[model samples]
Target: MFGDIMGMMGKLKETQKKVQETKERLNTVLIDEQSSDGLLKVTLTANREIKSIHIDDSLLQDKEQLEDYLVLTLNKAIEKATNVNETELAAVAKEGMPNIPGMDAFMK
Candidate 1:
């Protein structure tokens, strides 16, 4: 029993290191979106950090239009980021697991 415990501890440490590395990589994931008319663009990381936004000069004269485009573009970018973030995080979660011979049965 003691030997098994020690072995499990070693695996746990390796899993922790993998999870940390995966978390760091997760922060690097990014997604960008643009308006259909090409007047507005928004970029954001999977962690929800806004990287940048670009707007065409023509949209600046109309406050309402610009605001509309901003909302639309931001929503699109956020949606994409959310989808990508979830997928990436799920992959990391899978990675964090050590493939034990019988652990799958236990997990189920």
Candidate 2:
């Protein structure tokens, strides 16, 4: 029993390490989103950090319109980034998890 516990502990530690590595790797994965009219664009990392924003000159003339476009585009970009981040981390975590009978359900 103690041996099994020790093995599981090791696996948990390894999984933690892999999770951290995956998070670091996500920083390099980029996601781009733009407004429906293509006048506003936003880029984000899979880690959900905003990388850049590009707005058309026309948008600069209408502050309210620009804010609306930014909010919408940024939200979409953030959603995409969150999905990527979760999927990648979940894959790594599931792969590294030890065969603990009930844990499979939780992973799913």
Candidate 3:
């Protein structure tokens, strides 16, 4: 029984290490998302920080529309970033513990 407990502890430590490494790798990733009209685009890091933005010159003439488009594009970018983050996190959780029931729920 003691030996089994020790082995489980070791495996848990290994999983923790792998999870940390996975998070670091995810942090280095970037996701790009854009608006339907191609007038606005945004880049976000895995940590959801806005890394950069782009705007087409054609939208400059319409300030109101440009503002609306900018907001829409930014929302799209954020949504994409969130989806990517969730997917990556799920992958990491599965890789770390495929048999651990409800592990992801606990992690979240």
Best by TM-score: 2
True-vs-predicted CA distance for residue 48, candidate 1, Å: 1.6
lDDT by residue for model 3 (2-77), tens: 9977877887787888778867886778888888977788888876888888989998899999999878888877
**Candidate 1 lDDT over residue span 1-108, tens digit each:** 999778778877877777677667757887878999888988888777899999999999999999999998898888888887777666665655667688666543
Pairs in steric clash, model 2: none
Candidate 2 lDDT over 5-93, as tens digits, reads 99899989999999999999999999999999999999999999999999999999999989999989999999999999999999998
TM-score of 3: 0.72
Residue 31, candidate 3: Cα error in Å is 1.2
TM-score (C-alpha) between model 1 and the true structure: 0.71
lDDT of 1: 0.80
Task: Give the winner by lDDT: 2 or 3.
Answer: 2
Q: After superposition, how far is residue 65 of candidate 1 from its true place, in Å?
A: 1.6
Regions of model 1 farther than 4 Å from truth: 1-13, 98-108
> How far is 104's C-alpha from truth in model 3 (Å)?
11
What TM-score fits each model? Answer: 0.71, 0.94, 0.72
Each model's backbone clash number:
0, 0, 0
